[model samples]
Target: MLEGHQLLGFGFFVIGLWHLFNHTKLHALGSKSYTSTLWFPTTISRYMELHFIMASCTIFIAMELFIAPIHHQPFDPDGTIPTTHLHNFEHSSMAMSFLVYAIFAIVLDMKCTMAQHELTHFLGAIAFTQQFLLIHLHSRDHVGPEGQYHLLLQLLITVSLATTLMGIGFPKSFLVCFVRSVSIVFQGVWLMIMGFLLWTPGFQPKGCFMHLEETEEYVVKCSDDEALHRAVSLVNILFSFLVIGVTVFAMSFYLVMLRRYGGKVEYVSLVKEEHYREEDGFVKPKGTIDLENNMDDDESQKKSMQE
Candidate 1:
């Protein structure tokens, strides 16, 4: 029986694998036998690969924080003091929020591939709206009863951009790009803050080496507390890099998809047929198999051979 952290890590592993494994077969679905093994690749169908790529980080964080530490099991979530810090919740929830979007995006892509453009696009907007509001709410609360700080101002600026996005009717992909950009910058800013605080020479007290007097209920820090700190620091650094990587990947892939979509391709009408209209005298163009002029020559040659 695995512990809570192990369970959570296992769940992440499952999700991370699900999309990536399913991504490749989408192209061959429509051409061959219709089975559960097939998936058709349109813009929407192909995006599962990207979704999985982003969500993989969520699993990484889960394992780093919840599962094995650089030592073994670092017990620190309970030790993180200053509960008044709203940034704690904001940062912790970021991965989970990304997970939500990945799931919703998968469903939206499914709809879009089915040619349900309106509903699919609508769902995409709603997911964006959810994230925008979350950032706005968390940012608003971060200032604590007043809005006069620089971080507060930055939060408002981001909100304003989101508002502008809604007002001007930007395309869904563009909106996604905007969000991804802002989030990456914000993550870097947060990482810098964390590093500054950690290395401040005063963040952790020397006298309170084991946090002994804080609470009687508090258990002593594990003997490997130094190792725990190193684990935490390593994970923090890796997370920053992951965020940067994701931002670049998102931007590049979005541009690539835009390019591919902008190119002209063969047109196949997907509209429903009107069987109700009586076809009094309409002859559709003959297919290539029927258009050959060689049949007449073949018959003439046969007659000559008979003579």
Candidate 2:
């Protein structure tokens, strides 16, 4: 199977082509909020929903990656020792993350579950990391001498994973942004370290497959191999840009929006209170009672008038 990067190149090509021919329609999907619509009922909230999906998908896919073949892929592409421990750790932690979400969901009653909130961050990191990994794979750096079939498959996985993470619904909030940013850092650092390890002098494939060499690298790298690689590169880039770039980019703007709307609401409330105070200079407090004072005042006034 294609490891990861090759799939990204393929996906990028398709997305770019889609926009070249159908940018107008795609733009509309983002331009307006549809209250009656499931996703667009409130555009921001809808995006939050999307972020949740991406996060959940990220965890699920990561889990799936670990489940088969070896029943779990080593985090390392280079068959490095670190990959095993890291992958296992992340694998075990996933169950904990699941528990956290389950508890959060049970305790709170909100439109979104805790998993969705956490996912926002988890996915954000993947957004950048995946993009970097994918591009690097297609570049001179990550590509390898493998079967074309495997190359394309890897390319597909990378793209699909990136596409899934950089999806239409990433949230504009810090929750998602922070997670994504971190993911970005981790993805890059991890890949770079592994890429270095791949070339390390001591590194040797312990498996049965490393000694074999194909007629030509079966891995169809878009950079040197096929139209498919170049074709998908653009969209994958866009996805990277959209997912990581947008999440990071839109943060300040979201803060500004929060301040703007919050100020308006506060201002309106203040104005209404001022209006009421001006209209009724000495308004009685809510639930205020003066049983003794009121009764004594009434009797005193009555006695004086009679006298």
Best by lDDT: 1
Q: Taking the tens digit of each residue's C-alpha lDDT, what string does model 1 give over 130-238?
A: 4445555663232211112223334523543453344334323334334433443443344344334332344432221223234321111223656555534554564
Q: Which has the greatest TM-score?
A: 1
lDDT digits (tens) for residues 1-307 of candidate 2? 2222222223233332222222222222442431111121124552443344335445544543665236366445666634324333433343334334333433332455655544533443344344334434442222332222224334434543544354335433223323333333323333333333233333322321222224222222333334445434533443455456534643553454445443232345866885787798867789888687899999999999999
Error of 1 at 111 (Å): 3.3
Which portions of model 1 show Cα errors greater than 4 Å? 1-45, 52-57, 60-65, 68-92, 113-157, 160-168, 172-183, 186-307
| Clash statistics: count for each candidate | 2, 29
TM-score of 2: 0.25
Give Cα distance to truth, residue 251, candidate 2, Å: 30
Worst-scoring 10-residue span by lDDT in model 1 = 140-149
Q: What's the lDDT for all of these models? A: 0.40, 0.38
Error of 2 at 43 (Å): 12
Query: Which residue pairs in candidate 1 have backbone atoms (N, alpha carbon, C) closer than 3 angstroms, thus clashing?
Result: 26-39, 26-41
lDDT of 2 at 183: 34
What would you estimate as the lDDT of candidate 2?
0.38
